[model samples]
Structures are given as structure tokens and as C-alpha cells.
Target chain A: MSTEIATGRDIALIDLLDRLLHGGVVLAGDITLAVADIDLVYVGLRALISSVATAEENGVPLP
Target chain B: MPEADDARLARLKALLAASAAEDAAALLAEARDAAREEARSILQDVWREALLEAAAAAVEPRPPPERRRVRQEEGTAVVEPQPPEPRSVPQEGTAAVGPRPTEPRSVPQEGTAWWAYCVVPAAEADRVPPNLDSVDPSGPVEIVTCGELAAVVSRVPLSEYGDERLREHLEDLAWVERVARAHEEVLEAAMSATTIVPLRLCTIYLSRDRVEALLEDQAPGLAAALAELRGRTEWGVKVFAPAAAVAASASTEVAGGSAYIERKRSERAAREEAHQRTNECAQDVHARLEREAVAACVNPPQRREAHGRDAQMLLNGSYLFDDERRSVLESIVEALAGEYEPLGFSIELTGPWPPYNFVLPSASALS
Candidate 1:
């Protein structure tokens, strides 16, 4: 808790993305979401997750 | 946030004024706007028609007049001493939804789609804090009720949120960051006052009708899930340590060939034991914390690119605890962290999140 490892600031962007993309109430079927339309988006986010990791490491500021 | 929101709020007010004027003229225009775009236009027409039918079979039939009064309390129309509706305790082991309704219609306007954020029980619907901003710039957050449940949704323009366009945007990290933050912002605000079952990112529909239909079809699961979720909070903890810390200690004294060979063998054995111990440490921490949680899980370690840390992640755990139990969970995490810190491990706690990991009973259980 004391070595600056416990962040008091907001959680990292990657952490939020991890939960938002990977977690939450997902139902099956096309009833509410055309579950197919977003499959590629999920895949796309997987790639972004890695890119975000790189950007943060390089100290890249998001526009 | 406030300065910008002032202007946005003004614009939102004007937009509502214009829509209110239009509502006097046409209300049945946007049927079905579901994934297939079945977003029907709303309220008295759809709410009464769908709610009464669905309520009859689902939980309890809420009187239409009472529900309408609840809607008024949502805005500046009129505030009055409200009657607490009978608490609708769900009946377990029953298919509590109404008859199969007509196929949801796909009638989204050329430019906009309904983006639903989360579900709250109908009883708590009126208490949703107001003036919340949505993912859509001009779209103000609002609740659309069906039967025993209601969805917190807003209109997102299709130009930006359309399936093809949304997929394109997901590749842009900045765009994802902006939307992801905003999406969480809305849910976070709403969840503060009430229990909410959050939908994943990008849950768009054609109309509130389709949103209602989702409420109808999923009522049983929704009620059951809400029952389990009420008064509970989700928490996450991650542990990281340098890879070298998990490696055997090295010395510079051995120089002979046979001595070097013996050193290598012993070092390999020590390294194997260290790795094993490190894993046990992670498991032991999660296990101890889980004891204080209503639900708990260990997710895959995040990649270096994901966390940007020099230390390799050993644990990424999420736990759901009853509100009263959160302090007990924290004490457990504190005790574990203090015990593990001297071993070169650092534990980070993150949450009060919207039960993201605990949302699906079946999903979390299987994992």
C-alpha cells in the first residue's frame, strides 16, 4: 500500500478497457444485440489492448 | 466537466423541447431499433401495451397509473409524495415473462440507434440520478421501463456507432478510451444510487421497444441476477513482481568447471522451487480474500504491453462482496499484502466496479 504500487489516481486505461471489453452482462442470441456485429469489434479491441500497452510504455500521450 | 456540461445541458434542453413538440405529432415512428434495428418509438403506447402484457406473466402487474406517476418523477414535470409500490419479490423456478410478442421491428432513424448501458429493477427505476451524460454527445441518459425491469439507455447516432463504423473506431485506442471512459462514467454514476446489471460495451438497439423486448425475454434471468446482485460490490486485486525476484539468487565465487556444473544444477532446482512458491503465494492470496467475498475469480495475468510494468504480473483477481463484507475483504487483502510484500511482490487493489466480473452467474462460475 505504501510503495506507490497502490494507485490512488483513477485505475489505468488498460484496466478499464480490460473490464469493459472482457467483462459485463453479455446475453446470448441476437435478441438485444446483433451478437455478430460486435464479434470483430471484440477482436479489434484485443489488438488495441496490446497497442495501448506499448503506447503507455513509450510514454505516448493520447490525442 | 461542469463548464462543458452547462452548454451541453442547454443544448440537451433545447433538443428535448424540440422532441417534446414532435411527440405531440408522432410517437410511433421508431419501432424495433434492435441489433437488427427494431427500435420502436415509446411510452404510453409501447409501455402500456408491452408492460401490462409482460407484467401479467412475469413478476407482478404494476398498475399503469402508478408507473406513469413514476415516470413523471424522472423529470421536471411534477414532484409529489410518491407511494412505494409493493416490493416485487421474484418467484424462483418459473418462466416469468409474457407471451411471445411480435417480432421486434427494425425502424431506427437513418442517423441514430439506442445504446443501452445497464438494467435496474423496476422498483429502483425512479431513483436513478438525473442529468447524467451519455456516450453520445447530445444524448442525455434516461431510463426505459418494460415490465419488472428497466434499461438505462440513450440514443447514439448511427454514423459513429454503426456496426461497421464502430468496428473501425475500436482500432483507434484514443477513441476506445474516450468511449470506454464515458460508458463507465454513466454506469458508475447510476450504480452509486442503486444496484445495476451492466451491459457490455456497444449494446445498441433500434428502439426502446427492442430494449423492452430484451427486458421481456430476459426477465427471469434479470430478476434472478438482480436478486443476487443487490447490496453487493465487485473488487479487483492484482499482484506483480520482477521476474528476477522469482529467480534463484546467484553468487560470483564458483570458478572451476566441475564446480560451475554443480552450481548450475543446484540453481536450476532452486529456480524451480521459487517459481512454484510464487504461484502458491498468488493462489493463497486469492483463496484468503475469497473467504470474505460472496464470489471470487482469478483472471489471466496481464501482458507487459497491457500493464506497462517492469514486473511480471502474477495475479489478477476479482471478488464480489456484500456491502457489509467489503471491509472484511479489505482487511484480508491488507493482511495478505503485508505478508507477501517482503517476498518482492506488490499487490494492487482496484474496484467498487459495477460487478463486471460477477454479472453472469453461469459465466463467472464456469471460469
Candidate 2:
């Protein structure tokens, strides 16, 4: 049982983000945080990841 | 940097105001020269900061927090304790315990609220396991039960999770990493003990009563979801096409312009065909795995950038499997890997995670 739970440690940030943001049990409440902001962050993450990938491909050192 | 320099110059200017006229003139000239040098260094610093902020913004569109001196002085002082506040201290005996109910402190800290990590059946309240060491290190992860369901929750400053703060924090990779890991850690701990419906990251409620109200209102749906998820765990499988082998095969040399052009066209066609074949292979593998699991879902293939890998992802699927079927699922994954490895395809299996993909609150629960 411990091993099963421990496997979550191996999950990559992107994969974790995918499930954390897109799936899971969402309980809508009066909390003021915007879902739109999360979507923007997701978009930004995609852009950032692609930029990093392009940098890696070109052998350019990331800042 | 400019702020510090301005303060220093102001002090120097004041002292020079009382000095001899000629001496003050000489001193002021030297100070002016020093200020110019300082300005150049400050410009460079600003440029570097701009570059870093731009990079961070490209990843998550928000202004990065100002670079702090603590980061520069990191080697000198390894740990800096946060400012002492009444809210920082967890009430006695409430610190670092499993699912016991602790009195919620009504500290008048503004813009802070309860962030729920997960909800489990009330029957499993006592069995909620201890949390990971670094997660919510300063707060207690207590369970608040409403009728049949118990929610795992902790206090979070609303300033950090409110619209503006959360947006800024989400843009910062380090902050997101810490919070996301902590969120998962609590869920994993509760999951180790019993069936739990893990909530999405940053699920905040204004008060404990609100949290309990949510649990109460959604009790039936929550119970149903938990029942469906009982004795089951989720497994993730990602399939990738080997980049190195594909690149190697396409790099074969050819003679003359016309021959090179012909080879390039054929290579393009081959690559397209390989991509199509990989997709079909992925679907076939997913279908086989689905047969062996209780429930399954295929998420859209993740962007290559997210994984920081050169290979193209062919499949990103999650399967919910019964405890008894764990071995069968592992063997199927093993067989698929063996069958696919020779064709420049690879499969990575993860979890027995909390059934993140399977537990959705029924539509009626929301209303």
C-alpha cells in the first residue's frame, strides 16, 4: 500500500499539473480565485515549456 | 539596487552639506562619479532582472516577484525564519498529527481561509495516515467531517491564494512546484488509508463551516463517487516514439541534388506514416489495457515541451484497476512494452495513485 502511494513521487510536474488542473473533484464555492487565471497559467506553462524545448534543441543555455 | 544607492547618496550629501566649500565640491565630484558607476551596474542588474521576468512570464504570464537579497545571501544564512505572527503558531497538540479534529484558531488574520486537500468517508477518519514531512510543515492537516464525509484541510493565507496572489504565485515555477507537491502529498497520505476524492489544487473556502456545508450538501454524490472508487487505484501509462532512432534513420546520406530532394520527400512521407502508425499502436495498446481494468480514460497527448523530452508522446492514459487486478495490469504493461520496444516505441507506467481521474462529483451535486 505504501508502495502504491509512493509511486506518486515519480510523477512529473507536467503530468501532475494535467491531472491536478484538468481532472479531480471540483467543488464550486464562493472562493474569489478565478478559474480564468488557472487557464492562463496553463497556457503560459505550455508556452514556457515549448520555449525551453526550442532552447534545448538549439543548444542555447536557459536563463 | 537604485534604492539602496539613493539612500547612501542622501546620507553622503547631508554630510557634505556641513563640510568646507572646496572639500565639499571635491567630495561631491567623487560622489557623482561613483553614482555614475553605480548607475551602470544598476542598469545591468535591471537588464538581468528583466530577462528573468520575461522568461518567467513566457512560461506563466505574470510579473515575477522582485529578486530578494536573501537569494544572494543564501550561502551565508541557510534558513531564515518567517516573521513571528500569532497565526504562524499552530495551537498546541495540533501540530503534526494525523486525522484528529483540532480546534480551529480564529486568529484575526485577514485574507486567509481554509484550503481543502481531499475528502474521505467518515468511517476512515481515524485511519488517515501521517503526512509527508515537508508538506504544510507549519500547519496541521486536520480532518473536518460533515455527516458521512471528512475533508482534509489546512489554513492558507488568502493573500497567497487570492486572485492576484495566486496568479503571481502560479507564474513562479518554484512556488507552483512547492504547492502542487504539497497538495499531492496530503492526498496521497489520505489515499494510503482509505478511498478519497482528491480535490483540485487551491480549492479554498472562506471558513470551516463552508467546507462542512459543502461536504454535507454533496454527501450523496461524494458517497457514490467513493463507493465507485473503493478498492481501486489509478495507473498512468505514457507511450513515446524514440527520437534518436527516428532521427538516425532519417539522416541516411544521399548523392546529388535531385536524389537528395527525392530522399527528403520519401523521408517526410515515412515520418508521417510512422506518426500515423504510432497513433494506431497507441490506440490498440489502450484498448487492450482497458479490457483489463475497471475503468479507463485517455487524455490528450501532452505537449513534448511539458516533459522536456525529444520524443513525441503517443498516448497518455489513466486506468482504474481493482486491487486484485494490479498484477494483471503490470503484466499487460510489461507485455506491451516488450512488444513495442523493437518498433522505436517505449511505454512508461506510473501509479496506483489516488483515483484522480475517476472521482467526479455528480452533476446534481453542483446544483
Candidate 3:
């Protein structure tokens, strides 16, 4: 039988993402950007949002 | 005839000379008075606006309609006439305008500057042993007029790195944690010296000129706000149940089964029922805790696919409370945990932290 052991350090990547992106004092402003930079953030974010959505649809919980 | 002509000419010349001299003096006096009034008005208008904006944001839901007109761009409020009206009901498949409507609305931007920060007085900063300056040698520490409030500012602009790549780094959780931890350290320094009104994270200014402009524009009310926040601290408490424990609790005998296979089948059904109940319990517990807080926010819970190794369900939260009530709040958590223990739930609470989630740009600053 294979049972997973829990460690204090073993925080899920999604948990870390939640705290980092959504938590803390958010001070938003007119953020300047270049085309390349915008493309990078856009692509990365789209992938993340879709991946998480798919996981939820499949009945798998995201960390 | 000759004597008469000479006398008239001399008299006319004398009159013209005196009038010109008097006119020059009067013009100078008028300019001086205007200059003085302009200086005084600058101080009153900007400071009052900052206070009103900060105070307004502190209120619940949307701030005043006038404030919504002011857009925050790079730490400055761009005040323009209202654009075309927003749709009363957003159309289907359209993205939300402004920041997420569900999240907190963007309050008019107003706060103390990056360079001119408030710190505990010299004695207080010293007494703290590890002042913000010591922890981050890159920042300079300046003494402030207010009690124990000292300002610490970085020598170089973070934007100077000119690395658009920096935002990508921000996406990294470890990198974000390092920055967040640094911010936490500064706040800790403030607590040691005096009650601190922490500026929001990633607050950047164009230059020292802007910093001074912000400070000059908003000194008195900002000082008053700092006074109000003195002696307060923030704390966080999260409660969750490990899946295994919850699963085990639910696995009980339904009907007597002579065969081992029959008993196993019953256990499987019981576990599924237990898991569903536990999920619901976590949601209810989260809602109750949020209501109890002076200011509360919930980060999305991580699901089992990502954190499958963990035993407990995840509920992320933060609370801002008076320092004196710290023990009281802890006791409340203890009581809640005890009450829910029979249901297989546990609570974990942490902090005496800086007021990270509660720093709204007050409305008073907008006026």
C-alpha cells in the first residue's frame, strides 16, 4: 500500500500562489510594459487559468 | 512769458517722476502678497485632499461617486470628467471593467511617500534593536517629527533595473515570499517603535521629487492617521481538517456484515459521505471567522490535487484586531476548535503581524 506522508514544508504550489498573488497589501497603479513583457504575462496567465479550470471540471482539486 | 513757461515745465516733470516711483512700489507689494497666499493654499489644498481620500476608502463598499472618478495610475490620482456611462448590467461573455468587481474597488491613491517614511523616534528605533534600516542596508533611515515614526527609503529605484522581467519574477512564489518577508520585516520594526500605518506593498514613486511632493501635500492628516493606528496589530487564524482523519471518523458500521468483503464495502461508502460533510463544514467555519474580524479577507483554498499530501482541508485568512484583544481572539479560536473537535476539525492561528490587509486609502485624503 502506498500512502503519502505529510510534511510541514510540503505546501502545495497552488497554496503558495494564492498567498503570493492574492494575499498581502496590494498597491495597484498604471503599470508600464513592453510588448514582449505583456505577451509573456498574458500567455503564462492564460495557461494557468485554463489548467486550473480543467482540473476543476475533471473533479480533481487544485492545490 | 519766459519765466512762466519754465515754471510750468518744471512742475509737470516733477509730478510725472513721483507717480512712476509710487506705481513701482505698489506693484511689488501686490506680488509679495500673492506669493504668500499661493504657498499657504498649496499646503491646505493638497493635505486636505489626501486626508479625505484616505478616509473615504476606509468606508465600506464603494467610496463616494466623486472618488470613483479619480483613477490611480502609478501612485497618483488622475482626476478627469466621468467617461460614458457603464452598462447597468454587463453583457454576457464580457470581461469586467476596472479591477474585479467582486474584489475591493480601487480607492483613490493617496499615502505618505516612499522616501519620507515615518518611524519610531530615535530612541524607539534604537530600542527596537533591529530597526528597518539595519535589516535592509540598502534603505536609508531618516528621523521623523512624529513619535518613533522614522522613514526608511531605498537609495535606488527598483524600476531602474528596467527589467520588465521583474514582473515574471513576481509570479514566482518564492520570489514573492522574499519580497513579502522584507516588507513584513519593516512593519515589524514599526511595531517595535510605535503603532505604524504601513504603506501598501509595491508603492513606487517616480522620483524623490514626487516623494517630497506627496509628503508636502499630505503631512498633517497623515500624521493624524499614524496617531490613530498606534497600539494596534494584526493576526491570522486558519482552521481545517485532515482528509484522512475526517475519512476515518466517517468509516463506521452501517449494518452488521459477517464477511470481510462486506465490511470493506461499507467503509468505502462511509468515507465518501464523510468527505462531503467535511467540505461543507470548512466553508461554514470560514464564513463565521470572517464575520468576527474587524477586517477580514480569504485567499482561495488549495485543493487536494495540489496538496494531496496534507491531512487537513485549507482555509486561508487574515484578521486585523486591537493589540490588547490578541489573547481574547486566541481564546475565541480555542473555543471554536473545542466546539468542533467532535466533528473532526482543527484550528491553527498565527501572528501579531502588521496591518497588511486593512490599509485602505482613507477618504479624507481625497478631499
- For all candidates in order, the CA lDDT equals 0.62, 0.65, 0.44
* Per-residue lDDT of candidate 1, residues B249-288 (tens digit): 4344436445655665565565545555566777687768
Candidate ordering by DockQ (highest first): 2, 1, 3
| Interface RMSD values, listed in order for every candidate | 10.8, 11.7, 11.7
Q: What is the TM-score of chain A in candidate 2?
A: 0.67
Badly placed stretches (over 4 Å) of model 1 are A1-9, A28-63, B1-109, B246-256, B361-367
State which candidate has the highest lDDT: 2
The two-chain DockQ for each candidate, comma-separated, is: 0.16, 0.21, 0.07
> Under the 3 Å rule for N, CA and C atoms, how many clashes does model 3 have?
39
- What is the Cα-based lDDT of residue B254 in candidate 3? 44
Comparing 1 and 3 on DockQ, the stronger one = 1
Model 2 misplacement above 4 A: A32-35, A47-63, B1-111, B131-138, B244-257, B361-367
Arranged by TM-score, best first = 2, 1, 3
Provide the lowest-lDDT 10-residue window in model 1 chain A: A28-37
Question: What TM-score against the true fold does each predicted structure earn?
Answer: 0.65, 0.68, 0.48
For candidate 3, lDDT tens digit of each residue in B102-125?
A: 234332233222332232333454
Ten contiguous residues with the weakest lDDT in model 1 chain B: B68-77
